[model samples]
Target: MATQTLALTRLAASAWGCSVRRAKELYTKVIRSVLAYGASAWHKVADTKKGPALSLTTVQNSCLRTVTGAYKATPQCYLETEAAVPPLDLYLSARAASFEIPTETTGKLQLLRGACIKAAEIINRERSARRRRQRRPQGATSETPVTLWPSDAQLASAKQWLGGQTVEKALKEKWEQRWFHAVTPTRGRRELAAESPPDCGACHRYDDMLKHEASVLMQACTGRIGLRSFLFTCRVPDVPTPLCNCGEGRETAEHLILYCKDFKESREHLATQLAPNSLRTRRDLAALTTKKDTARLIVKWLLRTGRLPLYKRAMEVGGPPEHVNLFRP
Candidate 1:
């Protein structure tokens, strides 16, 4: 009985290593090796004067059925936590060599092993189903998908960065450090890509760089100043004026800023009247802009903003003598 129990334990260990679904497939391979060698050992022991009277073939079939069914029903993948192992006594015992068994019993044991393995598999599956229902957490609805939220650390970091005082100044400084004023590369060619889309200003000029720059400074001022003020500082014009040479129609914002004939003359007169020190450096008139003083200080503001085209044109062709709104005496 000890030997038989030991043999059964060894069979269970082998079966536990393989899945129930694949038990028969692996059993076929293992059975051949067991029969070839195990049968002789079984025969030698059974033929001993004191040994059990079992046939060599019978013992071999019994071992095969036990090992295959035990492994297949409870595969090793699921049994790692269970602290069970095979018995060493029967596994180490010698088998009888003289005993023999009918071939019919051998075939029967193979079939019985496969069936027992299948039964054990169904039992394991049913147990797992019951455990799942019992282990589910409360308040978690089947319809809701599991989701993860940002940690408290992440939310705190976001608030800290947003609350910092240096963000605006840092942004301005970063932009000022770049190379070109506004141009950027286009696909496959070194063409100007619009970092900012072209906008139609009151001046009706396609290139509205002056308005764009002034707008930025205006925003920095928190609405204390406006576009009109910025324009006046540049000496463009708060209101439209007619063209100088022809009495055709009233001039537009662009005319006053860059196209006006008299606007140029006024700027030149103011330039000559400036102090010697002021006339020499770019820093002297750097602060005043269109928003500074539109009506009275156009020339001073225009000088600061770098709109010299209208002035140059006026210098080349004399403008009306009375049209002197840009420069004050």
Candidate 2:
């Protein structure tokens, strides 16, 4: 119980932008995940009669390798441990080398511990090398720096970041570079790259709102419009707007889709399709569902499914919001 509690405490801290009411809702999910893994591990070690009695180090070592497989399934929970744990270098190396190391089905905590140790060593070595380079006389010319542009894959990712294209060919190439690139002091041009089905650039507070908007778009468009159905079959071209609206700026999803005159035509077109009769009085579709039940259904439809055109269209016009589309191919 203590082990799982420790894990959730770490998790709740990282789940940014949750309301106290919403946080209670989210906690059940977090607790379930922490307990699920802990329960599974406890069961595996139950015969030893050491389930609740294991040390923290023992628990961590048993959990690390399985952590990858679990992460691939329950990503949100994986994120809870992100800040407290070392980078999962063993997992990375396993991907890089493409070789499997046998782990005890009994548990993966030890494997994780070893991986963590190795990650620490690698980090230490890299830091030492960096200090050595810094100590060298300033007059010495450093090795010629690489000014590589995006490869085909990287270029596709770059385009995706720019909110342009999402061909499978393009996405595959972009991820290939993303998987191998070294972190440098200088930020890359495409650092802010986030598109639907990949990156979601929205405030945590507004994530649910954006999702509701997508559903409303989808529900309204699918039956009456051809564009919505077409988007259901294809990837929408993304338009990356990297400008931040933090300092008296107003380029958020609400501003773009509802308030901004730039998207007036598109918004009107959608409003006409979704709720044409309601369009005259409804200046803001988002504002229409202040009632909890209506809002919940809208959010569910938008965030959970891909049948609607509004969902994909919003994704194209707006960078990915937190309401994720699991159906995108």
Candidate 3:
């Protein structure tokens, strides 16, 4: 379990240490599949019991802590909310409910939804329980979770435990974070895995650099690099002041790469490539999604400014960044 969740250290190691948001996304993409295969069977079983000797909650909490880049003592609620992790029972019921009406965009998910519903109905219901005279979706399908459990009852237990917050609302939130940002239709499930998938923001891009100078530079464009404050959060030893050597203020990643005075000369040539908003503020920085050209500009500024070496060294110590050094950045 530790190995699976802690594995993010590799991804975090780039001069761009992973941010809390990015860590959460990676946790879902990587660790989630590892921890929850065939999860439905036990997802609801022991999730609600307080501190069971070995509960799914423990595993989830552990993973949540790792992804949020939070410490052992951080509040579980904060971690869960930051990571957009639904409460345990809520997650399971959502899984069960998804089968009740599958999200249609992803072919694979649709199949899984169909299987879970059909399998559960086949296994739980008596052969005679299938009344051909009753209404069914596909001519003569088995009773669905909605039919077996009332629409209101399905969420009753969840609401009771969650201080009246409906599973519908929680699942709706999960749909955006855990699933893609989908707009649920008034009458039916909205599309996910968009026909034109929104490109990843740099903060969420993940690519392990293997070799080649351009690729390394491109990998640097991945929003994996962190700054002084982030490294300090990771408890990196020998950290200098968060303030930049340039003396402007705290050395944030955006300032270091895009807006610092010390890098002004270096950034001069590259400045031509920047989107007007790219060099503006932190939100602009976070919004700098997947334009390979923008990464080139950032890396160019880093190299020209001579901060690249110090930045990479700090990152290596903190997360042990994993770019293949084909060319000298």
lDDT of 3 by residue, 244-322 (tens): 7888866555567556787676565565567464455544443442444554445445544554454444434443334
**Estimated TM-score per prediction?**
0.20, 0.21, 0.44
lDDT of 1 by residue, 187-230 (tens): 21211111212211211210122222222222211211223433
**Which ranges of candidate 1 are over 4 A from the true structure?**
1-141, 145-148, 151-170, 173-260, 263-265, 272-296, 299-329
TM-score, cand. 1: 0.20
Give per-residue lDDT, candidate 1, residue 11. 31
Whole-model lDDT, model 2: 0.33
Model 2 stretches with alpha carbons more than 4 Å out: 1-26, 29-249, 276-286, 289-329
For residues 26-103, write the lDDT of model 2, one tens digit per residue.
Answer: 333443344334332222211112333344323333232122112122222122221112222211222211211123
Residue-level lDDT for 95 in candidate 1:
19
Candidates in descending TM-score order:
3, 2, 1
RMSD of 3: 13.8
Q: What is the overall TM-score of model 2 with all chains considered together?
A: 0.21
